[model samples]
Target: MAGGVSNEEVGGKLWIMWSQGVLVSVVQSTNQFITVNMTVNNRCVCISFVYAKCLQMDRRELWNSLSSGIVDSQPWIVVGDFNVIRNDQERRGGRPRPFSAMEAFNKFIDTAGLSELRFEGNQFSWCNNQQGSARRWARLDRTLTSVECITMFPEAYMQYLPRTTSDHAPILIKLEAESVSYGYPAFKFHQTWVTHDSFLDCVANAWEDGIADHGMARLARKLKKLKQILQIWNREVFGNTGQNIQHLEDRLSRLEIKLQEGNNDEDEQDYLVAKSELDLWQDREEIRLQQQAKQTWLKK
Candidate 1:
């Protein structure tokens, strides 16, 4: 661990990539590439290193290795500096990455699809290791993923951290808890009532034919009806949460008193039943909160 940085470099300064705990190296890298195995979240994730080389090496071998190296179980996030920039914004000094690199990157993206994790933050990862006017930068560092990983943690994102010690920026990524989904439908008490078939039918039946102002009047009337229905629905749904919460508090209080006395017959059975009831109430209360969140979404 290079001064507590937890570094494991392979293949000298020419390259470094870690997958799981296993390290791979190519010491005499005139080609300047290496591959390593690192595990994330108790799963094997592989990284294959490719460097800026003039040689016309086909990436098929490296790509094949990356896709095939691990046992077919864990989700994979293969990433690092490949000396490749995916788009024009990634290049500084207005010069773009080579077409070959972009082509290879698109190929990789096509292989992975929308299941890949979002690579957030400013695109540039490495700057020209020179000083003054000749200096430049490019997006090189990256984190990629397999389909399973994207689904497992949809909020996972990568961002470029400012460089301090090295010319290359550190890639910072955070794993999103499995539960959050960006567009998961929130309960919209308002919208739900507006969209209800019975309400819509009532609105439609109120309109008469052959009147020019009838259209606008009917539309306004329908909206008002929708709003009224939603208000009623919200009161009906969320209004009971207070009752459920109060019931839970009362049960917990009684149970705690029984446990404190430390004396009665049927204590074990009574405690278990009380505990189960408390848990059930808690679950119901949580559902109420989620329902309120849905209502908030609807209001928006």
Candidate 2:
């Protein structure tokens, strides 16, 4: 892809990394008034003008178009100048944070379920070459991914390095994936089971039974061991059981307290919100528990 293409340029380019024996397919091109789409892995990729006075591709429109026009289902990589900074921290010393822009971009990327390639080295790329107390700068380049591409090619990442000619540093990205899992003391209960009086009583009884015949010192030791075992059991059972009825109960209780906090329901809207959340929580717990049981089995 060339550096001076118009905001509306679009085309394809192949990257041959002989060292890794990989041929990366990148289609570099732009659409109607939209920045061009770059290619890699035979997918729609791009170099967008995010901060221009008049954006060639409005964030929403660009994403919607690309999303609807997905090419072959091969791994994809879209890397180039986004122009928009992701966070306030990107600037040397700017306002606290630009949340609106961050949120807008986030919604667009998340809508596409884009996965950011974690590039090592420098986090920022663009810089103002001047040094006195007056030089200005920005981090304008970035690499993005489609949810599908991340799964197909997990080894992908971006590398930001010094640019000899332009103020903006060049970006290098590698694509790949690695599998992993963590080992921890597994507990036997779910969050829903956490606030259960019966569950608490059962655990308390188990601890008491373990120390019934011991002195204070011995009792404490025995209780500690019992706690560990109980926690492990909980991890084994309810660890992955995502929120359920009990969680909804908490939400409802909190909402009710809020709505009734100063004597009044703001409106039917508040009531409906609370009611809907409550309903989902109520009917979801059993199904959640069953699914949790399956996860527990698989983990074990």
- lDDT of the candidates, in the order given: 0.54, 0.53
Please give, for residues 1-300, the per-residue lDDT of candidate 1 as tens digits.
Answer: 111111235333443534344434322222344444544456544444445433325454445444445435455566566566667776666465568767776676666442335775445667554433455666667777767666666777886654434677777777664465687554344333343346555445443323444577867766666555545654654444457555644554454344333435565456456556656555655665667777667997
* Lowest-sum lDDT 10-residue window in model 1: 1-10
- Model 2 worst lDDT run, 10 consecutive residues: 12-21
Which stretches of candidate 2 lie above 4 Å from their native place?
1-28, 31-60, 71-74, 94-98, 176-300
TM-score of each: 0.43, 0.42
Model 1 residue 125 lDDT score? 68
Q: Candidate 2, residues 61-127: lDDT per residue as tens digits?
A: 5555555545555444555665566777666533444576666666767665666778754455665
Task: Tell me how far the alpha carbon of residue 156 in candidate 1 is from the true structure, in angstroms, after superposition.
Answer: 1.7
Report clash pairs, candidate 1.
19-37, 19-38, 20-37, 20-38, 20-39, 187-294
Model 1 compared with the native: what TM-score?
0.43
Best by lDDT: 1
Q: Give lDDT for model 2.
A: 0.53
Would you give me the overall lDDT of model 1? 0.54
Please give the distance, in angstroms, between residue 3's alpha carbon in candidate 1 and its true position after superposition.
Answer: 14
